[model samples]
Target: MVKQMEERHSIWLRIFHWTNMIAITLLVLTGFYIHAPESFRLFSNMDTPRMLHFAMAYVLVFGVIGRVYYAIVAKDAKNVLFNPIPDIKNLPSMMKYYLFLSDSHPDYGKYNPGQKMMYTGWLVMAICMIITGFILYNPNLFMGLGGSLGGLIAVRVIHYIINWLFVLSVLAHVYLDVSEGIPVLLSMFTGKIPKGFHDSAHTHDKSIGA
Candidate 1:
């Protein structure tokens, strides 16, 4: 049987997806070096990676803003935002599928409950990172606000913790995507997926109104 292709991601979404990925990868690398100048050796010296880190921080800021705008305009929020009630209801089946205890699961939306939760968490984490990052970047300017949050040391600690979370979450994300099948992974790059990929897994929840 000949399989048709379906558009899974828009050109703009794909572009932003990759741009954000690149920015995150660079930020993580440079972040590690900055966090531990003696241990991490991805860059020759602190100066270069520090510059790159600050530059990429701005890229991520705009990327987040643009992506949020696109999601709103494209009405894509339904596909990714975690709605506590329905998502909680669907979690058992999703967990079963992940645990190999179920062959099929309820179709939550474009993304499963797990994916929705993760994506939403990333949004929160990114915002946190940005806020803390800026304060750290200019301690004096943000000193008053930073002090309200528990001073510079507290902000630094939160930033470091979030950086680790980003690293670990990205690793899990890559593994889960590849495990689903290469086609699933490629869809983010090519913006298309084999026909019936979703159907083969389970019927999508049309009632969610994405």
Candidate 2:
């Protein structure tokens, strides 16, 4: 059989995706080290991890801004953003397919409802992390904000929780992508996938009915 390909991700998006991945990974590692040098022991000294952590935080800030700009300009928000009414309605079918209770799910365009929800949640979480991190990074600079949030301790706690959320969500994201197939996982790197890769299940359903 001849294999055809279709663009699944744009070049700019791939850039942002990989860039943010690196930044987030480094940030998480450095964060663990900074949080407890004795336990993590991933770094030799506080100076290096602290510097890398702050640097990656800035990288993440720009990566997010670039990704959002690209999404808006490319009109790709519809592919990833959650729509409450229709997406909520889509939940049952998607869940059924994932749980192996169904062989096929309705075609959900570029992404399933679950993916849309996850992406949207990640966006919100990233924004929250940025805000809390900024406040924690410089309490004096954001003293009013920190005080309003019950001081630096509270802000630090919020930042830490969000970091863990990022970790767990990224794991789930990778699992879901790979579960679909190796092609799905590679699409982010290659920016293309075998045409109709996502629609195969729905197409099978149609063929069976016909």
lDDT of each: 0.87, 0.88
- 1-210 per-residue lDDT for model 1 (tens digits): 665789999998988888888888998999999988888877888899999999999999998998999999999988988999999999999998888787778767689999999999999999998999999999999889899989999999999999999999999999988877777888998899887787666623322211
List runs of model 1 lying over 4 Å from the truth. 203-210
Model 2: lowest-lDDT 10 consecutive positions: 201-210
**Candidate 2: stretches off by over 4 Å:** 201-210
Error of 2 at 100 (Å): 0.8
Residues 118-186, model 2: lDDT tens digits: 999988998998999999888889999889998888999999998899999999998877766777788
Error of 2 at 82 (Å): 0.9
RMSD of 2: 2.8
